[model samples]
Target: MTVAALAEVADVSAVEDRHVRLAGVTRVFGRPGTPKSVHALGPIDLDLRRGEFFSVVGPSGCGKSTLLDVLAGLSKPTEGTAEFEGRPIDGVPAGVGVVFQEDASFPWLTVADNVAFGLRRAGVDAAEIARRVDYAVGFMGLKAFAGAYPAQLSGGMRQRVCIARTLVMQPRLILLDEPFGALDQQTRLLMGDELLRLWRETSATVLLITHALDEAAMLSDRVGVMSARPGVFIDVVETGWEVERDSRIVSHHRFGDITGRLWEKLRTESLKHLRDG
Candidate 1:
């Protein structure tokens, strides 16, 4: 993921579509010379291919979530440009969905309603909304809890509801910032399996920001490593797992190899971040 590589990716016409593109993008807080200024991210060059599951891993406080925010159009770059499908992002683009680490399910809304919220807000007709909600809810294995409120669901189930809500929108690209971080290890494994299935059935490109190297290695077609703050891609490792990959892949020896590679890249950066404090 060098700047030269990024330029080549942006120019490649072999792939008729690129779900996301970034060139020298940077995000900074306050004036350039101000003492209070913080350089969160910079000169990031990336091209996320359509329908690929890509994960980003780095030390905590390395601006991973800031990268997600930029991609989701929740924040703009202070320099350079960010684009989705070749168009500059002035706001959250169409056909892009986002899910966060926090529980996003509405307390008052039942599982079905929570999943249907976005479509309803967009003025989709009741019939269409019902159809999409039923599919998303059932697909997420929440049909049994369709009538259950967020208060009644387990933590993992609540995250599933959030994902179902995102799935219902049928986004072409999904930005996930530690969407499974709150779940227990076993639950995270199960959720990871479901996410793979969702990606397959929906054909959506996924860009996930996560601290879990195992999760990233098992779930992504490629895993990007970021340096400590003012985060930039250091390397992108190919997992070589098939499209039908799941958490079970963790038992494979290659999983350890991939995970170790990610850790090696991150370890120094993480130590650097800690030492700086």
Candidate 2:
């Protein structure tokens, strides 16, 4: 499968009305006597517009990942709701794509087969699957290594494969949890550019969770800062970069300013965490 083929399967307009809405969401953990049960998340209220790029950042242990888990339906909030459209999110919502920090491409499956996995699970017709898979593979520029197994690919390529697989699913909302966190600085920058290209081509609402303030600022329309344990959003700073979805946008003047602001905000919250600890 190639990326172009996958892109062909997607209807950009399909994402126009989709959004993720979290209202009064909360989560808690632990027993009655152990230090204080971890609240983990929430009491959050937010609206993620369609085709928009949004990010959440915080200190180590601020429940940023937990928030993603709740959205993915891998974990339930102790209170409130995480909704798609207007309904509560139960399990992985339909048309929702997920790319985790780890490279999840199957070790044994070739790149094409890997990208084809989700569509197959959905019982898509074979021809349709091939088209989508091909599109995804091409979109990620994996043509030369499409036949290679995960172990044969570089880490950056593996992540690209992961992104291809998710895109092939034609998801309306894509959830990325520090997808480039493990990469070296150079590779991370490349992946960010690739991600921006994919987002522009697919037009899906994306919610990315990352610890890197600059990364969040570089890719999102807004970055949500979460407080320490019993995590909840303390502030959301809008980044006006969505209008210029080009990879080169990172080098723009406003980029540094926005990223700096996000950094200060997250750093301040992290200090509060250290104090609380």
Candidate 3:
């Protein structure tokens, strides 16, 4: 699977309107008798458009990860509703994929085998799995190491394997919870570029969570900032969707201005949390 070939398979240019809607979503954390029962999320009302790249950023303990779980249907809300394609999300929605912060590539499987595993579980036939696996491996440029086990790959390569596995499922909605946070700076950037390219090619509805403001701005169609602990949306900044940037966004003249604005919003919310604590 060459880059051009994989691009063809993953291309989602024809996908029509597919959006997720969440209304008054909330989650609580703590044991029954605990003194520290806490609200991890809103009452959050939000909408993610089809083929959009959205990112959520906030201070530590701000429940950014919690939001991702709710979307993934890994955790149900204590209140409100989450919906896909206009239907209430009662459980893990079909055609949804996730990439975690931790390495999730199967340790025992070869890179190609790991990528194929998810497709197999989804009941895709063997021929289709082989075609899709090769396409994913080629798309992510993992062809050289397709036979390598997870233990034999570097951190970044293993992460690509994780991504390839997710892609083979041909999901329409993808959630990434700091998928590149575990890598070193350079590798993270490379992976980020790869991810952006892949997203553009797939046109998947992506919701990425990151602590890095610059990363969020560079990759997202909109960036949502949340208040610390007991999370709520403090501000959301929209960058035009369907635009492509090959240059470094941070080095641009307006970069500092946008980043500073996000910083202050986060800082103000964080201060409130500290005072409450």
User: Stretches of candidate 1 above 4 Å error?
Assistant: 1-12
Whole-model Cα lDDT of every candidate shown, in order: 0.92, 0.84, 0.86
- Candidate 2 C-alpha lDDT tens digits along 1-277: 7998778656443443447888898888775237978767778888888888889998888888888888888888888878886678998788888899988989989988999988888899999998888888998999888889999988899999999999998888899999999898878877888888888889888999998777887888888988777687888998876555754677889989988887777787789888877
Residue 245 accuracy (lDDT) in model 2: 70
Off by over 4 Å in 2: 1-18, 31-36, 275-277
lDDT-sorted candidate list, best first: 1, 3, 2
In candidate 2, how many Å is residue 30 off?
A: 3.7
Clashes of each: 0, 17, 0
**Candidate 1 overall lDDT versus native:** 0.92
TM-score, cand. 2 vs. native: 0.89
**Candidate 3 worst ten-residue window by lDDT:** 9-18
Q: Give the TM-score (vs. native) of candidate 3.
A: 0.89
lDDT of 1 by residue, 53-139 (tens): 999999988889988888888899999899898899888999999999999899988889899999999999999999999999889
Model 3 stretches astray by more than 4 angstroms: 1-18, 31-34, 271-277
Clashing pairs in 3: none
lDDT tens digits, residue span 1-277, model 3: 7999877665543222548888999898875237888888897988888989999999888889999999998988888899887777878999899999999988989999999997888788899999999999999999999999999998899989989999988999999999989898778777878888889889899999998887887778899999887788989998653457633665776667677878888888778777877
